[model samples]
Target: MGFLTKNKFTLYGVAAILLWSCLVALLRDVSELFSPIGGAAAMYTVSAVFLILVMGLPKLKGFSKRYLVIGTLLFVFYEVCLALSIGMANNRHQAMEMAVINYLWPTLTILLTIIVGRKKVSLWVYPSMFVAFLGVAWCIAGDAGISVNTLANNFADNPATYLMALAAAFIWAIYCVVTQKLSNGKNAITLFFTVTAVSLWIQFAISNEAALTFSINSSITLLLAGVVVGSGYALWNQAIIGGNLMLLGTLSYFTPVFSTVISALYLSVSLSVSFYQGVVLVTLGSLVCYFVTRDKPQKYNVKVTT
Candidate 1:
């Protein structure tokens, strides 16, 4: 109990990292099986149920209006952008491409943190970020590598899905940084999950999405994805509030690599060497950004603030 209590926050962060690594594959599976918008709605519903059972409903009485409103909006919007980007993909290969695009948050978050802290960043930081963006181009271009024709053609093929993924990366970076400020030592993740679930259902209803059909595989994927989605958020909330943010933030960039491995096998997308190169660049650049501010611990001082 003593050791567990002392390191619980760090453990939570680690667990969230591992669970989220599986999310891209699971998210793609559930989206394909359940029908994009409807599938996302169902996945969130299952996540809400899982959270309610695990943590019960969050107490709303003390949550600040700013945190309650803004936090909910950012989280829900980010979730929608992420889910829809994958769901709207013209194909599973595009879904994997979108996942790579979403992994840019680690660099974005670290950059935002350095700015928020008003600290002097290493000169290499900007170049690292540039390299990371280049990686998105590389990953998107596949074996074509990074070039005007290939990059433009690839992204143009599915402009909306690519755009949404780009938006998701930015939105999540803001959420990771701002959530600490607004949370007031309170974790509203449970409440946010509930709201996201409800909002998605509404979107699913109003849309022209096909009717959802039941499948044993779909049901099983939904259950697993729900647990991953629910527990990942809950644990991430705890980690941000009290865990080692620097470590977790650095580790977060691994999403692309893990997403590549998991989504490739799960979705049966045979990737090229160039795609793996992009994953490396994305992860490497983000990791460099994290170290750029290593001299300033408070730059990553992401603990809950009132």
Candidate 2:
């Protein structure tokens, strides 16, 4: 209670993290119910409505032109890539794999911070990155274990989904870095999400997907997903703008584990032993990255102009 009273933004960040952990599973289900682009369109449409009802319209005044233009573009693109990557997976099981890939953002975020912020880091950075990438490869390798052949084959089989998921990882990393630097205490999350919804709808309109036939359960899932997605972003925008990014990054280290567990259970799927092994490696890599730079001072300046 006392901590919450003092550090409410941090709590919001934690809440956002928890909500986002459920994202992969919900997205898979939603995509199963509606087609990929159509379901994503519907979910973000509900997200836009949910945010408007709760957060009111976005105020665009007083934002840095850089933040406005770059932040909006990055946020919108990241959200689209995130939705499409998982939603387009070949199967529910593959969707779970995509969750692992998307979580590469945590490590990438730290890595980008170290490089872009020009912060000094330990030699561990190299090994940490290797372990992280290796984890992804190993995860896709499944029972075959990590190998160049298996890893390449895995991606070859689903080039579009895998490429989108990988792009989402890097895009999100850049977004986290850029948004924190230029937010100026203002969050255009409502605007960004609204744009994302529109973008998704446009994609859906052009695609042949019929939005599938929604059952009662799927409809309920979509509503719940919309609520989670909307509130999660609203809270996350607050969090990244105010809370400790390093601490949040540290906490995010566990996202893949949480996501895999939730996704497997929610989707009623099984994962191979290697997949779990890869998850651990990926998490440990980020943990190591966190350790290397935990004591470094925040280089980027933040303000609450709003």
Candidate 3:
């Protein structure tokens, strides 16, 4: 059973990474039809429709009002911020510069858990956090070459992209914390639908500037995005449930690695020397967090019964 679970989670991690890569690649294509806002709107709109059809109105209506409202609003903001980040970065190099910045979240999440959940951090936690922090600093310094230029050249420039990425990370952290608190044994499917619907409405409201014309490519990409979100979340939930989160988080570093590769292949993105350096820091630092942090749940006994 243990071996089977491990193998399954290993596959889940790989699948999650791949799906994210595809989603990122698709975003580049979709960005052409509408601004990041429009693309996000389209994505959630499609997701909403998909959920209504598959899950039906009655089941979707069964969710708690709190879940319906908070989950949707949080994720909507996350998507919008994410799109803005991508728009600002524009290129893989620039986008990744901002992206590596967000590697801070996993490390910071421990401290956040400490503060919000009032969980005590183990002694080993600090060392890992420090290592991860230094790693993030290294990544920032290495990528500072591009970030500085972008910031200096245009204030309205891709600074928003980096800011958006940071915002997304922060919002995601909050969402994680809140979801754990609120979603005890809740129906993930219903929660997903509510979030999608609410987020779509938000996106549509904000995306007045978006082009309405749906090209064949954009439509195809939109469909792919919906499928990826729907399927990928299911698989990722399984992974977290079955595998050790510490180990899985360590493995999940491969997401950006896969993103870089996919960008290179499809988007014609070239890797910079500094980018590779950032990769090393992100990979190694995440591993440090995994190893140094206690993996066993007995220490804290966080009763996230959902």
Candidate 4:
């Protein structure tokens, strides 16, 4: 955390934000063409393949067996839930609920840290939690033009969409907790590949109806989303190795911002003032929680290279 307080760390963080924004923008466009399940299946399958190719070489050392096993299991749940949520969403607007809900991970991680690791949390943590929840309430109340009537119709017709979002949020929270405990320098890269591979198999097993079709454009997006973004997640571990937790956490608030922007620009989804306000409040509240807390070094001993 101390290392991350420097000028260089801020620059790298800005670069990460830009990279993530571009990735979300691309996903917003390609999602229209491919079936969510199909695109997700393709994305993770390609991700697994990419991980194997990158990590299978003899020069790279492998992860600890125990850490690899646990990481793979948690990641399996996370990816499956995420893909299902994306698949279930009718459009980008509905799909974004996943992002909004998933950001709860930071708060969840803090709570889980207290519960599982018996860590002492700062005083501001609980208030931050309430602020985050208030953001959710605001979003739910806002006039994004989505309605309870529409949601009811969707629930009656396709319970999968909403159910998937809930499942994704829960699983991702679990993944964050597990990562916080097990992540360390040498094992990080190996665990990244193992998790991606395991998640691919889990998704495959759940969705047995497999037919393959590809277009030049869709295929490229699949690669970028799966390979690039999936690997980008691994890179994120590197980012945190010496980066400011407060700044890092705050910058991640940009994911939803990017999601909202791409949805508006490319997907032609209108941005409601209420929705933006809700997002802004949620993001600001999270920042307040992060910056106001007393400084602590990352508890886990993690190191990364490339």
The whole-model lDDT of each prediction reads 0.82, 0.81, 0.59, 0.57
Model 1 over residues 1-306: C-alpha lDDT tens digits?
Answer: 998898899889888877877777788888888788899889989999999888888889879989899899988998899899998899888888888888898788878888899887789999999999988888888886568998788878989999999898888889878877887667777888889999999998899998899878888889999998788877877787677777776666576787688779888888889888988999898878877756565556542110
* Per-residue alpha-carbon lDDT of candidate 4 for residues 3-96, written as tens digits (9 for 90 to 100): 5556555456555565555443444444455655556656666655665565553233445565566766766666556556655566666666
Off by over 4 Å in 2: 1-10, 211-213, 237-247, 295-306
Q: Residue 221 lDDT in model 4?
A: 72
Q: Give candidate 1's whole-model lDDT.
A: 0.82
Count of residue pairs whose backbone atoms collide, per candidate: 0, 0, 3, 2
Query: Cα lDDT for residue 290, model 3?
Result: 48
Q: Any idea how many clashes model 2 has?
A: 0
TM-score of 4: 0.76
Best by lDDT: 1
Q: Go through the candidates in order and give the C-alpha RMSD of each one to the true structure.
A: 3.1, 3.4, 4.6, 4.9
Q: Model 1, stretches more than 4 Å misplaced?
A: 1-9, 114-118, 237-246, 294-306
On lDDT, who's better, 1 or 4?
A: 1
lDDT, candidate 1, at 98? 89
By TM-score, the best candidate is 1
lDDT of 2 by residue, 1-306 (tens): 898777888788888878878888888888888888888888888989999988898778768889989988987787788788898888887887787888788788878888897967789988998899889888888898767888888888889999888888898888887887798657777788888889888888888877457789988999999998788877876786668766776776787887888888888898888889999999898788777766554753321100
In model 1, which range of ten residues has the least summed lDDT? 297-306
Question: Against the hidden true structure, what lDDT does model 2 obtain?
Answer: 0.81
